[model samples]
Target: MRPTSEAELSAVISDATGPLNLRGGGTRLMGPFAGNVLETSGLAGISLYEPGALTMVAYAGTPLAQIEAALKSENQRLAFEPPDLRDVLGTSGVSTIGGVAASNASGPRRISVGACRDFMLGVRFVDGAGAVVKNGGRVMKNVTGYDLVKLMSGAHGTLGVLSEVSLKVLPDVEMQLCLRIEGLDATQSVEAMSAALGSPFEVTGAARGVDGSVVLRIEGFEVSVRYRATQLQSVLARFGAIDLIDDQERCANIWRDIRDARAFASGDGDLWRISVKPSDAPHVLETIGRNKATLDWGGGLIWCEVAKGLDIRAKMRVAGHATLMRASNETFAKLGRFHPEAAPLAKISANLRARFDPRGLLNPGLMGAAI
Candidate 1:
């Protein structure tokens, strides 16, 4: 349906049911078609701007690239640096502002800066009832009622259909550097990475691979980055980094791949994203050591390639959370794509679904009914 206004959009949604799929460019929503889809691409444009206050309100369907480009003119950027899913999905869909908030796709800088949810100021969306609603505001200090703005973040369009989003942008850093610390096993590397995070010196990116490779990044003024690079190098010497890469081109590409999980983009096998505590990384990885794997986010994220017949959910159950990053259609359908949670939370998700989508609509099982 072509919606020229918010009312038309609400009318389109009101009449749809039985798995309402919320789509922007239908990018990540690919694979299989299911249920009624509500496309927000028609409801697109920048509504308001507060450059002095470092804020902008944009329609949900507005492309993230557009927002970034506008922010670049002012040398400003999204603090969380949300990743573009196209790299991981192997599709050229322009990740929009709504999609970023919906998926909460934060990057390496998340450790120091914040998550996408952390920087979101407000949102205006149409609920399952097709009623237009607004939450939060363009300012930071408005903490009136329940934070529906943040609750909508990472909901993946399950809670509501986002029409517009308010965001916080920061002035771009002058310089960025990535320091490679090599030759430390997963255990030692995690300790070193954790130590760096705990220090007064701020390390923006911290990651370790299963192959005993660790990379740290610092972004700020040239002097600050240089000083932090040297200090971090000295701090991580116990792990024995043979070299440091401070090059601009190399640093940009490396972190880009890291944020997008390009290292494990081999689409032939099952790819899983396991999020575990830094301390439990070694133990959990060892538990699934037989599978092909790579560690990222300083052992916080484990990308494992498991056999088609293996119980991926069983393996992930040992960790705090996990997701089937990639898999065949049959594999996804038979084994399920999401990790299982406790029964109580399952009930809560059911209630939430009923509340947000009483007709059992809205990307049914896209994130699984249990979430």
Candidate 2:
């Protein structure tokens, strides 16, 4: 079912008797759900944009490309650097802004700035009972109390169906410089990233590829970028030889590849995304014992490919969470899509789901068992 307007969306939900699998752009499909498809693509458009204020408001189903174009025209961007997962996931449809929020998608820059939820200012969603709930506002300071704006993000439509979102944007930088340190092992690479990230150079991206090359990005005015690059090179010189990539297009492509995890886009192995303290990254790598992995967010986020049906979680001795990002339906059903929360946390999540989706009809079993 596709609803063209908010009222139509609410009516459809209000009349629903079973699970409703929420869909936006059809790009990041994580479901083998038992429910009628509820498409939000029809509810697409930018409702507001203030370049001076560095803010944007768009309907949940609005294509991400459209919003990026608009932001680019004004020399601004969604600083969180949300990744385009269509290629990695092998999906064809356009990516929607709602999906970005639902997944809390962020790229390497996330280590410097924040995640998708950090930029969100407000949200308008239809709860399970078809009740329209609006929280927060266009400006950052307008958000107070419960902070449902953040609550809606990364919820994956379990609590409610997002209809619109307000976000904070950042001005685009004039120059970008990437410093590459080659031939470093995982531990050394993480140390190098830690040094760069800890520096005052304002490194925006830190990632290590399967090729054993560490890339750190610095952005701002041309002179500032050049100055910081020099400083960063000196700091990282102890690690290895540093190659400065000043070409605009080349740097963009480098980051784009890291952002999308292009390394693991192919092959038949199941993909897993593990999040842990940056310092514990080396141990996690040792535990997983997979050379085919991409470290982003300065090693806080690890994307590893493992053979299907192999439970990486069981092998993990680190204190972190692992999500089964890509797998067959059977593997997903057996292992579950997300890591099981601890008993106390699981109870809190269950109570939240119960409060928002009283009927337990919204994306049931997509994140785990139904509410």
Candidate 3:
């Protein structure tokens, strides 16, 4: 089933008697689901764009590339810097704006800016009861009372099916430079990233590759970038040898690799994404020994490639959550997609699902057991 408009989408949900597998772009498929496929790709196109206002409104299925191109023409961009995981997940399709919102995908710049949810100004979605719900508006001040716009994001389509989205954008940076440090162990890498992030230089990106190379990015006017690079070099001299990458293309590619976890793309194992405090990163890496891992968000986000069916959660001794990002169907079913919530939080989530989807027909069991 494919919906072309909000009314059509509502009607489809209203009449559905079985589980409907909600999909947008189909690039982030978690596992095999038991339901009739409901594609949102038919509901495409940008509804509105105001360059001066730094705001954009697009239908749920609008191609993300189209939105980016429009923003680029205005010298602006989505500050969250959503990542393209098709290569890492081995899926082929144009990533849709709705999918990006549903998954709340953000890249390396999250360390400086925020997640996708932070940029959302408004949202339109269809509840499980076949009712159209609109929350927030095109501008931030209009988004008063019950911030459902944020609540919908990162919900993974379990609460409702998004029909349209309003987002806030930022102007493009004038220049970007990456400061690279090699031969740092995990502990040293975290300390270096913490020092850079905690500094007054305004670092935009901090990530550690699988080969133990740490790169810190600073973006602004050319002079500002150059000035920060010089100061950061002096501050980080204690870590190891430093290399400055001023070539725009090279820096872009390096950040892109870190953004998408490209190092783990070609491997043969289930992929896990762990979120922990920057100070606890080394411990997490030590716990999951010998696995290929890449650190992002200043070491708070760790992407580890482990043997299939190995549950790292049982071995974790720190305070963090692990999400199974890429795995075989069998592994996903046995382990689950998101980390298990605590009892109280689980009850709250169940109540939310029940309130939004009384019929339990939307992406049932995709996130957890059906209500």
The best candidate by lDDT is: 3
TM-score comparison, 1 vs 2, better candidate: 2
Q: Looking at candidate 3, what is the lDDT of residue 227?
A: 96
* TM-scores for candidates 1 onward, in order: 0.93, 0.98, 0.99
lDDT of candidate 2 vs native?
0.90
Candidate 2 C-alpha lDDT tens digits along 1-371: 99999999999999999989889999875848888999999989999999999999999999999999999999999999889888777788989998898888888888888999999999999999999999999998896789898888888999999999999999999989999999998899999999999999999999999887999999999999999999999999899899999999999999999999899888678889999998899898898785488898888999999888889899888889999888898998898889988988888888899899999988887765797
lDDT of 1 by residue, 1-371 (tens): 54656888788778774566677765562335477667777777888877899999999888888899899998999978887656555566567788888888788888888899999999988887788889999888976798988888987877788888999889998888887777676688789889888877888888765456788888899998888888877777777743677788898888887787776665556777788888888787777867766666666777777776566667544557877766667766666666666788878777877787676566667655523
Candidates, ranked, TM-score: 3, 2, 1
Q: Model 3 residue 156 lDDT?
A: 89
Cα lDDT for residue 129, model 2? 94
Worst 10 residues of 3 by lDDT: 362-371
Sort the candidates on lDDT, descending order.
3, 2, 1
**How does each model score on lDDT?**
0.77, 0.90, 0.92
Residue range 152-242, candidate 3, lDDT tens digits: 9999899999999999999999989999999989999999999999999999999999999999999999998999999999999998789
